[model samples]
Target: MELSHEYLTENREYKDYKDFVANCKLTKPENFNFAYDIVDRYAELAPEKRALVWIDDFDDEKIFTFTDISRESKRAAAWLKSKGIKKGDTVMLVLRRRYEWWILMPALHRIGAIVIPATDQLLQSDFEYRTNAADVKMIISYDNPHVQTEIEKAKVNSPSVQYLVTVGPDREGWVSFHGEYEKCEADFPRPEGEEKTYNDDPMLLYFTSGTSGYPKMVLQDFTYPIGHIMTAKYWHGVVDDGLHLTIAETGWAKSTWGKLYGQWICGTALFVYDMNMLKPDKMLQMIAKYGLTTFCAPPTVYRFLVRQDLSKYDLSLCQRFSTAGEALNGEVFNKWFEKTGKKIYEGYGQTESTIICGNFKDYSEIRPGSMGLPNPLYDVEVLDPDGKPVPRGEIGELCIHVEKERPIGLLMGYHKNKELTDAAFEGGVYHTGDNVTQDEDGYVWFVGRKDDIIKSSGYRISPFEVESVLQKHPAVMECAVTGVEDPKRGMAVKASIVLSQDYVDRDPKEMEVEISTFARENTAMYKVPRIYEFLKELPKTISGKIRRIAIREKDNKKEDK
Candidate 1:
């Protein structure tokens, strides 16, 4: 399959990319399964092709061929079925990038079960909510004692949960997944009923990072894998038959974005680094040691990488780099571009969708801060609250045109929440709840989320813009800006900040004055944070996203007292 020049061009409008994106004329098969179509098909065509390369903190490494994956998944499917797992059964996975997760995911798909990926960082409360809300039946997790304790506590409340399966080591009460897999037949046939599933059958469920309330379940169908062909091939510039590493745990959606579906579909060998904890230098060393060709990570990781000396590592093999979790700061972008000639291609999406916006590989013009344009298959726009199109350079809610039909990559709906789903499309647009401004040149720049916006003294302020400015300060390591209640100004901009180790003991009041003065100098005075609180670290979600809501709640409680 030749790459489409039209779909790969940068700065092109949706119309230009649309012609080529949907032109391939691959008809949707009635009972399509990714494990069957993409993985097994590739295994049949190229049996010896390397599909996965994995290493752990203990320097243990293993390589899996396409044939190996296909065979193991069959065994896993047989084992799961023998345990009474069936079609549409919800199985929660908390395997943190273990090699077994790679096999289990496809096996679940082969059985037509919905795979819910969760991080091991989940606390007892998080497990209780997700297990009950999703009616999860079985849990397959790593043999970590902390996670085991949480699962045991949550099991009392999660009535739907019936089985506890542990990988790696045996727990007293839990079933040993590794032991069961060894005993299962390797050539067990795929269930006959799997042939009845269509392209629209729900295959994956992801819980949104609960920054506001309980996390909403975002469901994606089997067709979701088809959507990421662009993500792996173009956005990440994944080279066929080369090693690609994306730094993310299995619990996050990014794992699928880089590790599983798209990379294999593109014929690239996925690289997994299963570490107990992240060490920037150790990660750099792994890249050099493994000869990794393409790399992708969140902006927060890049920020830390920039602080380290680039010359210490031999990163010549790394040709492509990409970022997603949050918008890339211009400072990190420029520094990385300077160190490596390769530009960091920034893509945008949520747990609800695939890569919807990106700076593609074929594009020559790379904007430092723009999130590129809307993906070709998606009819995206920036609309005001009234559903009217906002003019260029004006901030508005980012929406996709649902009247035309939701794209293949989009979530089916907020699972089991019709009110939220209907509200999302009530105005004839799929509201992203994110604010953005498109430039005259057609690149979109992210503004703060609608709720994250601060209204102080009649002026609306974007927390991202303010936070970006604060990040540029030498003293600041990380920060989250939120609106706090204020009688005088409706809402006040409050910054909860973590200073660099060098500045930790320094007087916070003095640092606050400096940050305030710096913001006033760089941006409008109204946008400057009215109050600053210094901390050793900002509270973050399990996925490593800073939780502004937690800070806001703390401030509100303080004000009430």
Candidate 2:
């Protein structure tokens, strides 16, 4: 089944990518609840149209039509409302890529409640921090033992979370999600008058994996999805009646950037793979198994993919491939191109915004490592320290100017943190905190992050947090953490340590393993250091500052054995 929706609302016509960016306009409706405006509309128009095709490790499959989604979400909404959940309340979802997430998220939007999508990998302390920070009222989670145990333990500190709803099988003190959904009424009526959601209503809340401090809460209005028209239609090269697979967790912002909004609006069937772990061979098999048409993932996935025997699978069904979350490495792009005869297109954006820059198909030529031109919907520029546009070939921060108006689909601001929100949106511009350089040809090359943040396996990590954990050891005097170049992870966290006098004489190999274990126990798996270097002293600049850049430069220049 195919659906028809124009790529643009205001400027509904464009000849090329250049024309789209220069003359783009958005038509924001007064009360634009995506759940009713898009999802239900699809159900009314094309009830039997496939919205999602889901698969799991057990080879269990589920396909949902627009009518099914519309029905299930209404029931889910009625069930949630009966639990005393109201508009403006925050509900956290840790469904772990389960099919239930698609239904439950729309349910929250229908009720005008703020939906917080969280990863299943979070520990007890992570649960405590996020729950308390957002004043989360209820938590709907997967039935995994680890998740249940962690939340049960975290509740002692999170007094505000009043409800615990578990999906898949009953737990002792939790509501069975499926049982309740089956019993709840399928008719959910819209709120009347002022109680109804508006275009500027905060519908989505995302916790950004910050590079330096604790994760910040990103608040997005209901119209955020409207900005991704270019992302799917032009940048990702998605077509109507096509199958699109974006390799991202349900928690991360990238999922919505590719999975939900733009793809559905373009009438493409979304593909979801619920994997216990990421395996390149298994993923390649799925592409052939399902005959996926368009695919997108982080560069790390491609790095591992290129190392596999791709000749065994038939990938001709795929018409386009894209990479985001980080810059595409030239080697991986070249290797994949040579093997599969497909060029990996690159795009750029952050948690606070949708696709800011991308090599939009039909507009710009693909430059292996460059982020394509700014999307016409956003006024993006490479600004130097003074906040002025930088000359070509010069490095600058990627900033989005909101002088005309706050771009549709951009985050409203950091929730409950006016200081941070003001600082980022200072001068009527949103700073992306990423550095890049552009050539005269208008292609932007990513230089690095302006702060000490690590991009590994598509997760943004804080160097400060990892270094703080390393310093907790009694045997450590001082330590510095930086990202080391890696083909698989984009960059691996490397720690150079100065052991205390008593621990200096200890066996180096034995100490290495001990420290590694210590790091794993104290920090998240993604933030743990992979490479350890024992140093008598860390390199310091004239101002007595640790030269972390020196460490990164040294690692980049190191010849692989």
Candidate lDDT scores, in order, read: 0.84, 0.83
Kindly list the per-residue Cα lDDT of model 1 for residues 1-561, writing each as its tens digit: 212222233323234433435542223456668787777877888889899998998989999998899999988988998898888999999999899999999999988999999999898889999999999999999988999899999999999998999996888889999899878886755457544567788999999886888889999998887778778876898887889999999999988898887787777899999998878899999888889999999998888887888789989998889999888878778888898666899998888888878887755367877788777667789999899999999989889887967777788998999999999888777888889999987788888677777889998887888888888887888889899888899998888889987899988888989889988899887888888999888888777777887888898899889
- Model 1 misplaced stretches (Cα beyond 4 Å): 1-27, 193-195
**Candidate 1 global TM-score:** 0.94
TM-score of model 2 relative to the true fold? 0.82
Superposed on all Cα atoms, the candidates' RMSDs to the truth, in angstroms, are 2.9, 10.2
**Candidate 2: segments with Cα more than 4 A from true spot:** 1-7, 10-14, 452-561
Model 2: how far is 123 from its true place, Å? 0.9
Query: For residues 58-101, what per-residue lDDT tens digits would candidate 2 score against the true structure?
Result: 99999999889989999999999999898999999998789999
Candidate 1, residue 478: how far the Cα is off, in Å: 1.1
